[model samples]
Target: MQRKLSKATTLLFAVTAGQASAALFEVDPGPYDPAIGSFAAWYQDTHGRTLDLCLSKNVSSRVAGAPGAPSYMCSLLPEPGVFDDAEPLVFPTNFPPEAFWFTADAAIADAASGIDLTFGAAIEAAFAVEEPAEGDQISFARIRIRVDVPTIGTYTVTHPYGVEVFDVTAAEFGADGGRAINMTRDIGIGAPKTYNGALGGDIGPFLRSVNGPYAEVNPATGQLDRFIGDPNLDEPVTGSPFDTNYVRIQGPGGIDLRTNLFAISGKLSEVVRPTPVIVQRATYSRSSGEAGLSTQQDVFAMAPPPPATAQYLDSAAATVPMTEANATGNWYGQSSANATPPATVEVSADNSVAIPNSTPTTLSAPLVDVVSIQRAEYSLNSGQLTLVASSSDETEPPALTATASSGAAIGTLGGDGATKTLVTGISPTPPAKVTVTSASGGSDTEEVVLLP
Candidate 1:
């Protein structure tokens, strides 16, 4: 099948027209997106100063695998920007900063075109646990980093999540610390989240008004003071979600032993996102003569299956349809070609199609088709017929060569002289009757089917 352009197209987009132009590079995500989700960077200071620069949301799980053991599109690393190795770009702070500890899990982009443009320093910031303490408050380190590239093309690695690369200008440190200055700051996190596919969790940096922000040193606070709500301090709180950019103070609670001397700035930074999964459709069929005892209610959530027959029969296979009733088994369920609604099954034993674990099953279905192939037209040139293969790839034209037929003059076909190879020119001299082959390996005998 012809391959089509995907998310990787932009990778090779803006390249100069020359031999020195940019080249496309493919990198495997390496089992990421699901396993280790995103990370939230926070600060908890010694003097009870607390702040959540990096917001955390109560995320929910969406993927529902086979019924036996629920699985999701597991990702090994947390995020490319955090989990992956990062070079510490120094903070040009005027004060002497002290302390830093970094965190990561893998999926990050380290090098581009084999070039090690990574930075690393020390991480000294607020954390959950406490370390050595100072007198009043603890200080942590922060670094602002960004990248600079001469030509325009998709960059493999970016400090931010969504953006592929940090577009910078020649001017460095123009108020906004970008490529020339090497810094990143603003970061947006995912809003709605899931909880292992069961329930959805809510996370935000706003201090819960009941106490403080959405989080506190002790309580799971979800609070924040509104600026526009009560312009006079008496009106009701607005429905707008809490914003955290204004609450950038170093977290309190014996966080850093060093002074307030850090902040990582960069051109761009991405929100740590999780891999998304879908719940598949599955059916349990017992059309093999006899039916099982219990119905859907019999579904043994934790009970061991009936030794021999149970395990082998994955009653949980997803998305299988009841098209046709084969002499052997039922064919795919018949349905209107236009109707795409998922086919349904019953939990009733009367139909004898229910399993003990009546919880229900569905087959893994695609939200959309990625690629499809269809038979196109059949064209005959001179004495040869050709079948065209049409599929996902439609960019460049498709061309297939043909073989000539025997006893037919090479000139039999006027224009298509350039295609055929073996059976060329009037079947290698008339009297020599030969048959040509088609792509499908089918044969076509020339006009003289009669006795040559």
Candidate 2:
């Protein structure tokens, strides 16, 4: 239903510092339909301030408080402490594949200074589009605004995703970071999230792996590993062994409520288990020779490849309904098979601590050898030990281990060591040469100076 703008409710955001508890405001979130969707809000400040706003057509499925669904969250200013107990409004659950539109209007009855409504300013707005969400036609745009006043002097208002208030301090809106989204009648929605589903676009495949409705690109390689379905299933499987990105969905295996902050990935392939490994054995009866004609018997086919590994990437709430192309806007088109998956990002006390140390301080030098020169992986001369590190993307952090040259015992390094300390043998006075191996087999080394 369309709610027109009203004056009394407009100035809700303009409450005076001391007693604006009754300040009114409006907001509407939706599990939008392809048709028409929008939300409108208004409020009047006790100080006689007016406000009006609307969010429609652009937003992710509400995580909690949403129309048609139960309240998921509230949108109070600054810290959410005040609105913690506040409840959100609900819209009709059955929107019949329509869009969402909201309109808000408020009137100001008071102000801190003697103000005149005369020579009032015209409405102002700002918008921009992100390459990640921008499709052949559609652009993931965000809107921001600032108005000059006789009192507040240039007040600013912005809504990037249209649903959530943005922390607009960032420069170039990166993934998860809000960017400008431009919309026009000529623009079209980006590719219907590349993956397909029974619901015209089943989020089941992606939701099955996501912490929320969004998906992040693989930081390690920017490519993706395979999974069963989307994590946003209408009903998640219980006891599921699935990795929890940020939160868990329960259904099949068991109900384990958990979450993760990693990227979501994987090719959603159907597993027809209980199908059977058929072994057509030939009973060589004397008749075997009778007709050399059809003596061919089929043996059990190679076990269908062990189900593919699971992988996932994190996505922006605005990036709901991901496309075949990387929503993070990296190349590879969000394709899983690409070799340069985005590398995993890990910030450390030292961003320059790139090279790894020996796995075990043994008799030999390298306990583990990071093979890549780019540092995706490295080999450590753990004296008698060696670490066999399986590397992923090189840009982020590299995994390492040190095992004995005997191939029997192993040692830990850096974090902890069971056999021997990775750096135990390095001299405290002089630095040693440490090398890191890249996925491509290149090598780079660093000299870590030890101190007494």
Candidate 3:
């Protein structure tokens, strides 16, 4: 889960031998491959503007119940109070510069995350509109607000949550002369109550909870009854789905207003990503017959579930290069098209996979397998040392730790322990040493010349 380099080997690449040196060897994690779900950071402003939004993408989400749930992977925060009314909302000129890959995931998340994250910020201070009377099956949907003031710190207080009414606007919630940022039209959905499950009525944020018999009806009875022979209560009262698209802002004293400053669409995203394999159950039924010679026939049927595939990007399209431009600027997208194809390296316990003893090794390969990296020492024209990697990290797609001095090349593995590959294109002129450590405590060292 971590990327690091050895202390001693890093020194070998930085300074001449036999002299006291303080230069530290550093690991360079280049081109975070979002294809494999890696994290990337972005700042709305290039110079770390306090008022601009700082965003991180490709973060992993842990759902409370489902261990097998796809990680809901991404979010963006819209920071208010930081920006003054005079500040423009455009990209580059008034906003932060791009620091990472600019893909649909990042951009869309930039919008959607605001709604989800805002709801998240509101969750803590949220309380049931009213305690449910015993035995009442009511599911509530809510939209919460979080406000942060610099120096004074962040303060989240419960608000009487309400939905934006067409032709009607709620009183300002913040301060006088305060600016309101409206993202409602840009990202907001239809009225809050439009989809209140079975309860056909107007629904608003923090309004009345939805009542439900969220179940399938029996065809014969045309009612919320169970199948003839099957006896079970109606499905549990799952709350109605809520769509959030608008956020209202008010100045300091709850005076001025902006109805929708920002908005983004919500995605089922990774949480429900389809699986490659699915198990489906088939039910069979037979009728009862009277006495002696009665006979019955059994019917058999076969139905195979579709294979799960990538939800966001198709396998083929994800491999193709893409260039996208938004209001901010053009960004290089993540796709196999522009990426270096991973290399495959051979692992060995002896010299079987080793380079010639006296011949120079060119950085032609740029990928390696974790297994090929046995605990061993590699010597360059000047320096030699043993490197080890570990497999202790049992997390799927285990974390990799790598270290190298300046000019050292790094390779991307196809996957955990699948195959070994060398990082390619590094020259042998600078005599740099690269060490890769695994989560399982195994290590490998390769010394190569890296010329600029």
Q: Can you give the TM-score per candidate against the true fold?
A: 0.19, 0.17, 0.17
Best by TM-score: 1
Model 3: how far residue 277 lies from native, Å: 7.6
Candidate 2's C-alpha runs over 4 A off are: 1-205, 209-233, 237-242, 245-452
lDDT of each: 0.21, 0.20, 0.22
List, residue by residue over 1-452, the lDDT tens digit for candidate 2.
11122211122111121211111111112222222212112212111112222111112232333554332111111113221122331222222111111111111211332221111111111112321111211111111221112321111221111111112222322343222211111111233321001111101112222232222232334543233222122223211112121222111123222222222112221121121111111011011134432211111111111121111221111111111121111111121221222222110011011112101110101111123222112224432222223332322233444332233222333422111124334212222344444323223344433222
Per-residue accuracy of model 1 over 1-452 as CA lDDT, tens digit each: 01122222122212121110000001112222211121122222111112222222111132233443322111111233333212222221111122221211111122232222332222223212222122112222222333333332233332211112333332432432223324322111112111111011111111112111121121123532111111111111111112111111111132111111111211001222211111222222111124422111011111111110111112233222232121111122221122111222221111112122222222222221111111111222343332222211122112222333433332222222122323232322233233433222123333323222
Stretches of model 3 off by over 4 angstroms after superposition: 1-151, 155-452
RMSD in Å for all candidates: 23.8, 25.5, 27.1
lDDT of 3 by residue, 1-452 (tens): 11122110111111111210110011112243232222111111110000101122222221232343322221222234421213443321222211211101101112211221132211010012222122211211223223222111112222122233211122322342121211111111122111111111111111111221113332334544211110111111111112222233222233222222221111111111111111111111112236422211111111111110111121222321222222111112222221111321111111111111211111111221233343323345334433444332222223455566553435443344323343333334333566665443344566643222
Query: Judged by lDDT against the true structure, how good is candidate 2?
Result: 0.20
- Model 2 TM-score, 2 decimals: 0.17
- Count steric clashes of candidate 1: 108
Worst 10 residues of 1 by lDDT: 19-28
